[model samples]
Target: MRRSAVLGGRYVLRSLIGQGGTAEVYCACDRVLEREVAVKLLRQASVEERDRARFADEARLLGRLSHPGLVTVLDAATSDEEPYLVMELVHGPSLADCCRGVALATTRVAAIGAQLAEALRYAHDNGIVHRDVKPANVLLAEDDRALLTDFGIARLLSASTGHTATGTAVGTAAYIAPEQVRGEPVSPATDVYSLGLVLLEALTGERAYDGSPAEAALARLTTPPPMPSTLPAGWRDLLLAMTALDPADRPTTVEAVDSLRRLAAETEPAKPGFTGRTDVGESPATRSTAGSLPGSAVVTAAAGQLRTTGLGAVSRPAGLARRAGLAWRWATAAVLALVLVLGVTLWSNTLSGRPPQRDTPAGVPDRVQKPLQDLHDAVEGDR
Candidate 1:
């Protein structure tokens, strides 16, 4: 029989929300505060000496981070025979749930992706790498907020805990980086790669490399992705840079983040009802809505250029298997291109008889609106 709840002095577990390889997260109530919190309990069977240390490490990690888009750690402790972390309860859907039902608008996806990048930059700067980043870990909070969760498999620079064969594979296979597969020491670049896959899933409304976990992992080593033409043009090179087979070949996470920010800037004038900070070469109306993501995470300039190095400087480890992986990418790309061509041809035929419809609204002018209302004004005044 399973216990329905863990009744503690300060907190009471309501039900389990998620169970991973090492930890099980529960929805709990803080008896003192009378508020809900997520209590992540480390599975006793999974708690090795290193895992216990890692559990303790999360408190220190969360202490260093303060961001609106990140899930905050409220408290941590070990009780009876369980180690638990109390966290902010994010009440909303997962990115995976969103993707399964709806293809996110490009701007919305960019907004979410940008926020995630900002969080990653902050973590990387603080010498932490969120080794496992995936859709399930991202929460769409109420009031249209995008929050990142689940730092259980995160790696801290000062810790000896790592997924180097002796440990279980850390990340979801679909989002794992190439270097991680080879058992090489990981850096911020690995996070960039995983985030790239997140962005890829965001855009395509499908997995970038899909199949069994084993097949997907094999594909990552050998798959040269088809050209960016299939993706919204804005995301092409950024994805290529992040998903490059060689860890050295991939752009630094900070650079990739900057590229995303710039792309968002270019998109500002085109999005309707935007009013944020404006920069040079942009209209003041657009300025108020540009780069002014309130409560959005920030990447300090120095950290943005941390370990400045160009892609292609770091070489993929030399091995027959890696070379074969490279060759496999070319082959996979060819197949992908062929499939793309066929799909386009079929899609063209479906719409061949109908006239093209304009994307802009019919009655409204085709121009960006100087949003008379801001988020704060709308939420506060109206309510």
Candidate 2:
């Protein structure tokens, strides 16, 4: 109802598909290229130079990033009152939609993580940090290929990426890194943390941390989530390393790619012509859901529009902000818990007139901490 047509002869608009704060995406057919495409139009009134500059900058940035998992930017133009971008139209469901009460098979989730990590690595090498890397930003193709979308909130590695005019936090709250929440300059690690969260959600069907907005912000900044071992062993180390509270402690993109590959290999069989589906027949509850398909639905031909499902539907801006705040609070609580445990241990030792044990002799290891030492050596060696 906002506007009828857009971009004139460049692309024929079919219908509005989505609307955001400053943009509206439409399903359109590219006349020149003769292909179905998604056209995103900037909705902000261009009364200020900064808005125009940022809009143009995003288009330019997207044009530079070329990857199979990333959404392809085909054309950019300004029409009537807004800027427009024509991009590849993809069909499938978002990770959020599929993330409701449903837990994806471990292999499928790892496959998605691997694809997205590769995309992030490519972007980082190109000096682009996808500030926003959440479920909604990821498109699961009909064939289950992971495709990243919505680079609108992406930050260039150089210069002041983007910020609220009134000095408020930008970027998606739940997915935003601690540095971003603290108004610090964002780095590739910021995206790494976000991607880690995505992997966690895909595996556990639960966010790492959740609470009100202030609490969530504090949580991400102060506390690290429990180890992935709390969920499953295959991906525990990988997720733990990726979500390390200290950016320096997180694994590099290459490491992430390797880890995810291992996880995928363990869960999914390696066959010459496997398309990520085994074609197992439906069980008893195939038609339980009125408007859904059976569990045994195989991945054959590409599906249609990405249906809204599960966590993806929880993307309300206000709720997102509140959730982020809540996560910060949970993080704070985690910090307090760690401190209390340390305090209790120290107090108990003090009462018993015993001092905390120091490291064993440099070359000779103590038998008590031998296993601990070995673990330390393995982790350090891996690094």
Candidate 3:
């Protein structure tokens, strides 16, 4: 656990990051690649043939999965009777760290949920199941993207590790799926259910199912998750679908991911639209070509608003269509302004108090009178 141990003849251990029931994760230096890496070593006391195979299986599965949202496995081997996995060292706080007491921002929670769902989908597509999905398994980097980690309990669909029995529970109590608790076979749906509970905890900053481990695991057999009020639109429904008792009632991990991504977009902060507003540190060319997406769903709304001066509230994307849209708004403004000015002039002329000038009557030119009638009709039509 100290900072000087080396592993696999290359990774020099720096410090212990954290530990789980099966493994201890350490921050290490990959002297071969000159980069910092994470090393997961099975605790000496828990080391066994079955445990070692499961640990190695996780590394092999992760080695096959290449995703930006997933923590990359660099190597796995038995070093001095202890099996270890070298992985990409992520520098960030875990989701659990962020959700210490108060609920995180809905946008952040939704975004994390979306990404972890994506990672799960990737694993599922490759015949692996992350049996555990909770706040502790998700890391939040400075980039704000969620990184999924710790597949220590993942089961490969095709290979029989023979570690878990058919009827034995295998996940954390608070976030365990009902089927998992009953010792039923697991699928992607199991991860979905667990992720739903994790999302609920993230949103509420409290475990929806709380009690002793036994009580929590057994409660889901009959008690449904209590529906909450005042959530973002469609969020409650999504969670309900995810945590449904029957696998058929739950959304697939892919579907859950899509819903979560949409929810994230909906709850994101209001981003400035592509009008022409200058952003700090953004070059004019950059602003025109690459409109800043504040990662929100409000771009279209912001784009729809053009000020009276024909300038947009934010720099718009560079394209003929954007120019055309702006041009259309200007044209509309010009037409409205002309109509307004003409109407005001006509109204003032009609007022008897200002009737010093000769009124256009019987002797007036046909052009003037015709235009007047046309304008009056146009104004009336508008009303």
- Name the best candidate (by lDDT): 3
RMSD of 3: 28.1
Full ranking by lDDT? 3, 2, 1
Model 2 error, position 378 (Å): 44
Worst 10 residues of 1 by lDDT: 285-294
Candidate number achieving the greatest TM-score relative to the actual structure: 3
Candidate 2: Cα lDDT at 91: 74
TM-score of each: 0.64, 0.66, 0.67
For model 1, what is the alpha-carbon lDDT of residue 381? 18
Report, for every candidate in turn, its global Cα lDDT versus the true structure.
0.56, 0.58, 0.61
Q: How well is each residue in 194-310 modelled by candidate 3, as lDDT tens digits? A: 889778767755555543333443345434454345454376678767877666667888888888888887744322221211121111110001111100011122223322211
For every candidate structure, what is the RMSD over all alpha carbons to the true structure, in angstroms?
18.8, 18.5, 28.1
Clashes of 3: 3
lDDT tens readout by residue for model 2, 105-209: 778888899999999999899988877777767777887779887776567787663533212234654566666654457778888888997777666555555
Better of 2 and 3 by lDDT: 3
